[model samples]
Target: MNVSSPLNNEFAISRRRKAAMIVQMMISDGGNLSLSQLPESLQELLTDELGAIRLVDRDTVLGVAEEFIAELGSLGLSAPGSRDGAIAALSDHLSPTVAARLREQMESVRFGDHWHIVIDLPNSRIVDIMNAESVEICAVALSKLPTSKAAAVLAQTPGERARRITYAMSLTADISPDAVHRIGQSLAKEYGRPVSSAFDKAPAQRLGAILNSAVTQTREEVLGGLGEDDPEFANDLRKAIFTFKDIPARVKPTDIPNCIRTVDPAQLSSAIASALAADEPVISAAEFILSNVSQRMAGQIREEAEELGTIKKADAEAAMSSVTSAIRDLVESGTITLRDPEADTDE
Candidate 1:
């Protein structure tokens, strides 16, 4: 038979029972515990032990808390048990933008680094950030971007300022990695700025897009009036417009195949015929489309147009509009990019 002395009886609590008593004692005294920080398995065990155990003496509860505190104090350091937990711990040490960026990039291999995230920013955003930030900051961001992206962004940046930023790049070879990372993180945050307006595109872009589907005469008439009254807006609208005549200058040769798929084969043939029968720029645009397509396909388009006989002026206008509409769709979806129109190119 086993005999228990009073001292043994007082100290007889099991580990789990002691843990429960300590937890209850802490709660009773108004201490808040973030029990959720523990590993889920341990949390479940603690919850179950806490619920199953009933009562403990005041001395036993006090002793358990002392032991728990002693053990915690004896540990030199404690690391967060998970990657997310570790990020949360150091989040206070970082700027909010960098910290949030770190959390987003933690699970993504695509970004690789902060500079790469900035590289992935649209060229327009990069230009905006360059315009808003100091010349030195712009120089750092421009240097960090890939050669191709940097060149494209610089093309859009103001000429004299871009030249200054470019020259500043020569001095950036000795910049510290930490400075570059912080600059990139700041730019990315800027890129993430919320749009205050409901519309996704600018007013001029919206007006031009609506005009794209309108008849050629309607587009010209509206622009003529806008030109007299609102020349600045008209100029912006002209830059945004993509007409059948603008095809050769704005659309790419390689993208011709995708446009062919976008419109019906018969419709594409009719548009080309319509353009061919029209004036200089329209004829060139027709030739651009036909030449870029396969030889067999080009031959077929000519054959189909011939079989359809002389297309009427109204029919031709409608057909050409269809082609332009398909190109506009491709541009909107980011599937194809338009070439920058030359200064002399008329809308």
Candidate 2:
């Protein structure tokens, strides 16, 4: 992505305009770019230049030119780094009034501890602020938000709550299409069954509608978890579930199995673990889960006995005995990790 040659496409035009605005504002600030505020690559390049501490105006200008070149390349702009030509072009494009307004905004701007913007604006405004790279102030201000306000922010967030806020909403949902598919893979691992991709079974129009309606935050969280565990299945699932909000609360039990059939048992277990782990002791709630199994499945319960070593052996045996059928079903389905000392030793 050469920054010097601005891609003439719509995306490029918009990005170039934004980039020019940022560059103009930065130069106006006595070229004093805070170390934390610079892009990662630019920071590294500047660090190298600052190391020699070269002070000559010509030398300094050359260094700045180098950075400009780097930025142009990275930004994929057609503008050259040579001061006389590209800089003049940039000057013409950025009006003094626009630059002054931006500078004024920058002056009043206060970055919090995280160095993000400190404003509570609308979501669209938040998105704009993110583009301005002024989100750090917001992160600092976020801690002051009341619990209810914080919750509302979180609900509106699309990815990791803290990250989204910190990154000024620039941080997209860590959840990707690949991650969603992986969740199904994980479920299959635990269940030893073929997990289904919802996209595969449903009509494209219906699936698209479901995804469009899904909760963004939920979809991202689920996709992230799935991606980390099951990349392939996550990709598959990405096609099946367009949005997390697609699933409704009033799902029929019969429909539940169809969804379950698409999920891998290990994935299910992981989801269960995650759900229980979040301020809830899932292990303590194991009994409720166990009650749903049958006698044949109960025989497989002994495999998990060893994994329960964290608990007393006697207690594990007692718990397994108490919910033998359910535990066995979990074991057979691969929902629980069976402690195999041999496997542990090899690892």
Candidate 3:
């Protein structure tokens, strides 16, 4: 867990070659390598007298040297060794044009922060890193990462520890860039390789999906902890979760008939009646349910509901709750699927 020397050794030979090449380039150009002449990545690696050079293997010296030449050429100034000489020097190591194109491609490729490095790590290694840090620090670190990555890591962690980490993340409001960079550097040094991948779903939505599968007590505890740390964030997470009430708006109209058939007819009847009896009935919910059922079935349910008269508010709610819970279960079990309204509109 000690990250004193986390950099991968696999790139050591290449790094040394690049470092030596950079030194050669500087010497050839009459030691005129200026900070402004380097790519941001190379600039960050340089120090006074190159005292602390830590070349990232992601780029080669030839590549950076080409960029340096192009930058100088743009300023209408020749490189110290002459642009031709520098180009020849770079071409001696690698094709200058190809290297420059490769560098350009590298520049275009984006990698997420150090947290991404952690996610790319093996689960056992990720757990080890998490175990090495305090819950608060780990949570804050995880919170800064993409939600899918954070959730994947948390899901792999032990349940109790995961809960604590979730609580800590919710409480964390601000994390400095320095801290994140350091964490990422340490992780990259220890466990990462140069790689890139796309992110999916917002953190709230991903976390909501994970929580939806959780046991009620654990879900409540995590939400309660989140509520304590940041109520607004907790509210957002809650909204991300699709509940029974969300069905009217979220469920596909085509899927409704099958969903209705999954519930008990009597239970559906009582639930509909209770919904109708509410001071301001959820007309959308009633209509949605009725619209999905056959006309005869819908009519029969209406008659049965009328005979039932005014059921107790609690009874009505209980009946409705059961139907709602059933719908959620079906969705979770893949028996039904709800289309996201926002996603539809976006299309």
User: Each prediction's Cα lDDT score?
Assistant: 0.80, 0.40, 0.65
Error of 3 at 115 (Å): 13
lDDT by residue for model 2 over 9-119, one digit each (tens)? 322223334344345447657796555644456666554533333222344344444656677788744654443334334544676555433432331221212122222
Task: List ranges where model 1 is wrong by over 4 Å.
Answer: 1-195, 343-347
* TM-score of candidate 3 to 2 decimals: 0.39
lDDT of 3 at 34: 52
Model 2 scores worst on lDDT over the 10 consecutive residues at 107-116
Worst 10 residues of 3 by lDDT: 103-112
Kindly report which residue stretches of model 3 are placed more than 4 angstroms away from their true locations once superposed.
Answer: 1-185, 189-232, 279-281, 344-347
User: TM-scores of the models, in the given order?
Assistant: 0.46, 0.16, 0.39
Q: Report how far residue 213 has shifted in candidate 3, in Å.
A: 13
Counted clashes in each candidate structure: 0, 47, 4
Write down the lDDT that model 2 would get.
0.40
lDDT of 1 by residue, 217-253 (tens): 8999999999999999999999899999998888878
Best to worst by lDDT, what's the order? 1, 3, 2
lDDT of 3 by residue, 1-347 (tens): 43233223433435434454567567768896555545556655644324443443435444655655666688955564444335434644775456443432332122334455466676666676677778877876676557776677788788888888888877666867777666666665554442333556777878987776554456679899999999988988887776445667777777777777767877788878877765343656887788777899889989988888887866665677667667777877998876664564531
